[model samples]
Target: MNLIGIFGTSGFAREVGDIALAQGYQPLYIARDQTELDAWSFAGTAILESEVEIYREIGFAIGIGENAIRQKVARRFAGQLKFINLIHPSATFGQGQRQIVEARQGMIVCAGVRFTNNIQVGDFGVFNLNATIGHDVIVDDFVNIAPGAHISGNVHIGPRCWIGTGAAINQGQGDTKLHIGTDTVIGSGSVVVKACESHSVYVGIPAKKIK
Candidate 1:
């Protein structure tokens, strides 16, 4: 049986393990360091970074939910293990979906994710449970679209962005696309209609900048 090295031990990690199991692979939880490896008492089998080479080549997945941390762990394990995109069987990419122009590896598309046509998804991103992504959308690398979030058409989500849970971003009109700048955080349950700037925080009914 193929073994998947999941790079986290959190509750979300366990959830990702379930997805790995659905993909017909065994979940091998990866701990951050020797301390974590020594103290790990989780249900699944786990190991430290130092022991990855012994397996020769194992499929890897980042079980982390944090965008920056996901990128960090991915880069650290880039040449070590083979990265794999873990998409749940329950996720739907529209009825007759067009192409998803994916750039790199280790994308985690969870249960009930619906993707519309002509979407461009970058590397190491997470489309969480029940999130809806509309047409002509571009999700950059290391982005985390949290559960129940809705991204409308012509949306450009920047790198390392975290679209919070249950948030809704409305569609952009002709000759314009909603551009969310790099490293921005869209707060949970916010309704965004306007473009967001880089390295900022937006939260409200209209999703104004709070930071």
Candidate 2:
């Protein structure tokens, strides 16, 4: 069994652990501290590599709070770490299915249906349930795409972005490369058509870029 160590013991971490086990990996709970990690390593338990690779593998960072402690720990242990991917049991991926595509060990794909080559989900990104990602789209790391969102084809979402619930990107015609910058927020039920810069909040039709 591939022993998978979780960085945190929070509810989110538990949820991730469940997925890890379902994916045929052995899940071990580890505190988000260097001492605990060292202890676990000393105990001959393999630490899960989830720092740079998770961020680098996926487009964004999941479970990253404002505090820098976790980041520091991850950086310190990245060399000996092993990252893993978490996919819901209900999720499916195959040929000709209209949905998003996450890279190898990339993105947290929740239960949902996706099209063939519709969305390119970056490493450590998240797609909540029941969301539809259209074809030829790019989603960067640390992105949070809420449930029931409809993303059309040829759209590009940057890293650390959040696409809110029931939002529609590239709804209807006017096919273009819709870009959302890093750390951007798309409000609920919003429609985006144009390109967005980093750290912008967008809402309404045509998606005005707000600070």
lDDT of 1 by residue, 1-211 (tens): 6898898888888889999999898999988898877877877899886787787577889999998898888887677778888888888876445235233589888899889787888888899999999998889899999999999999999999999999999997896889999999999999999999999999989899999
Residue-pair clashes per candidate: 0, 21
Q: Compare the candidates by lDDT and give the number of the best one.
A: 1
What TM-score, to 2 decimals, does candidate 1 have?
0.94
Error of 1 at 192 (Å): 0.5
Model 2, residue 14: distance off in Å is: 2.9
Query: What TM-score do all the candidates reach, one by one?
Result: 0.94, 0.68
Q: Where's the lowest-lDDT run of ten residues in candidate 2?
A: 58-67
For model 2, residues 97-190, the per-residue Cα lDDT tens digits are 3233434333456666454464556655667767777767787755777778877888888877788889998833466577777788888899
Per-model C-alpha lDDT, please? 0.88, 0.62
Error of 2 at 55 (Å): 20
